[model samples]
Target: MTVMRRTGWFTKSIAAAGLLLMAGQASAALWSITYPRPLSENDLRSEYPVALLTLALEKTGVKYSLLPSDRILLQGKALRQLKENREVNVVWSMTDAQREKDLLPIRIPIAKGLIGWRVFLTTKDQLKYFKAVSSTDQLMKMTPVQGEEWPDTKILQANGFNVYTVPEYPQAFSILQSGRARLFPRSVIEVLNELESDDLPADIVLEPKLALHYPTAMYFFVNKGNATLARLIETGLERALEDGSFDALFRSTYQETLDKLDLENRTVFELDNPSLPPATPVNTPDYWLRPTRQE
Candidate 1:
């Protein structure tokens, strides 16, 4: 929603100011942490994550510069660049076995596990059909749409789901609106943001009854050899957690969305994520969003 748009600039401004405060100090270890470019000139989804990264650096009291790539870099390309130590040195993405091995992951999920909780986006007419689904077998009866190369596709397929895929992620929205697909499972964190667009069909709405859950650990990854920078970020994040600033930032950024979803009251269909790396700190209760009524 425009909520992040309004508050995000101020957060960014604070981060920018924090960066200015670090100018001219300890030039030897001084490093430039480049992130992926914005999806568009106005894309602001990265605001919270960026702010958290800045807060981590601020906590370290280190002289570092945060810059975006000169050109656009999608998730795969960004991760590749980070692995190659090219244009970007940092990227925040959901962790898998290969990614954790190729780069250093901070282990703390940047979204506090909100990225794993998913809900369906479907046309108005599909409400009754979805609401009637109380079991995984019933849910899998209808195929849902996902991005072509997304890891979620493999996860869903492994769970016996026949997921329809689109080459371009945005095409899933069109597929739903045109009745070409019955459902499009989207991260609960992203559903509200995607709905704010004025161009989407009015009939498309969230299917609230049946929700999907998995272990989605989004971490800030740097090259495996960049141990110093990795420690800097991890230290900052752990400090933020200890002092409550990390939860504060997370709640401020996502509580509104979570409250609207009322996830605790819904029937959560838990799914397995074989892609999650062995190093993921799933045992750390404090690092996840554990709703009281999860099923």
Candidate 2:
């Protein structure tokens, strides 16, 4: 599906105008939040978080509107909203020590650890190239492309993999398609849908038998000063979990994708996330999606 794109300057102007208009409306909601746009052309994963968050908020009986935010320059730029106290109230990302300290995190794995499983995007011809490989050592020999500011790029480099870093999201796929990089790793929930939605050239295909595993989770982050919003999210998410709505939504939204991926038949290479925060609830079984192993 096509996602309408607006430049950051225009987006901020719209947001300012929207707030002004919202203030004058008698029926205006109690809460307003913004979401990031698709990272790739015609992709719609950007709206996935919106749906989950909306359901959670609805459970709290609080009226809210999820708007599209300005394009972000850095993944952590949203965290700066807390310090600068901007209007961008809620954002989500992989957790890190500095991020947890800077923003209020709900501490639940919103995607059920789906962000940690990676499926690589590569050219069709490279299917044979990958088939010839047998181990992480061989895969590491192939260059991977990632966003310049993404923490995953740093994690890959730290693990001794050669990575091509670009400053923007679209450039990573372009670089991979142009053969400058052999692979672009994306989450399991992301890769298949992106390929389907992007209308990408026929040359691009998902590497069928490889999956990368790491320790990470996407958490809903709120500004540190916005304690009310934080409590609303925490309470709402807890209710969803206790009522099994979270798991039901998870299966409904992603079970088909996981089934299509046939994860059990793939080679699961576990990678070390040295960047994972110490405060992460690694031992909390109820807080994560542990489909592959015993907790």
Candidate 3:
């Protein structure tokens, strides 16, 4: 009888332990993250927010899954669906005012800054016409791309410039090159990259002028209902930044790309040096790790 009672007690204890283990496993949340584009050989993977989130997961022991989208539009649509169904957990690098109301942001920023300024590019002979146009207002008098949400287009239209919106950035450039349009405004870095790839003729010069400055911030957005996961990611990112792990990971992945792009010599917004900043001594909470959500 004594032996039977001992055996029964042991069996009950084992069953209770098994039940607890199952509960823990069931409570482990699974997240689906959407990226702005598919992974490509030339894609800037190191700068990708999804990769950073993966690193954060490793540090935090969070379970997650990824679903890559081909474009920003698809990502927005998928994220919206997920939000409506309460099925999606995270979306990366989204910027809009409406998204802020529904999503919680991870404190670390994904994009460097809001791109401002537009350089007018054209063949050398035509540069004289734009020499006096120092600002968007002055340049608005010319016929440009219409219906596009380009940085300077709306401002130019408001100021009485005939604006045309092309379907794509490359199309706009092509139009300028083919003499269909007289000017094209683009970010300096983007234009430089394009010029490096295509090797434009000596006549093509990018005019230096401030066009428009817009406010934008990129972040890892989590559904507001998944507050626990959001908080965990935020804390994990903070810890990673504090321990120098995040910078090390970024450098290991991106240093070669930076050198290739000639951006190695250029300073990142936060660091004085071109190299990645040490994650430790990151004293400013709002400086690097502040969460910002946009609609």
Which candidate wins on lDDT? 1
- Each model's lDDT: 0.80, 0.76, 0.50
Candidates 2 and 3 compared: the better one by TM-score is 2
C-alpha displacement of 160 in model 2, angstroms? 1.1
Candidate 3 residue-wise lDDT, 1-295, digit = tens: 0001125888989855754564365347675555545334333332446666777766666576766554433344545654664434566542443555556665465433322223446666666776576455555565565325332454455446676677544456556666666776543324554454433454566544323323333457776676656655665665676687776765565445334433222211221211212321234433332212222
Error of 3 at 194 (Å): 5.9
Query: Residue 131 lDDT in model 2?
Result: 86
Each prediction's total of clashing residue pairs, residues at least 3 apart in sequence or on different chains, is 0, 0, 13
For model 3, what is the alpha-carbon lDDT of residue 180? 64
Candidate 1, residues 1-295, lDDT tens digits: the string is: 0001125788889855644544333234777889999777446667878999999888877778998899988777888889999999899887777777788888888888877889888989877787678999998899899877677887899889988888766678788777767899888777887677555578888887778998877789899888667766876887898899999998888888888888888888889998877767777888898653644
Candidate 3 Cα misplacement greater than 4 A, ranges: 1-32, 39-47, 70-89, 114-133, 139-212, 247-295
Q: Sort the predicted structures by TM-score, highest score first.
A: 1, 2, 3
Model 2 lDDT-worst window of ten: 19-28
TM-score of each: 0.84, 0.83, 0.52
Which model scores highest in TM-score? 1
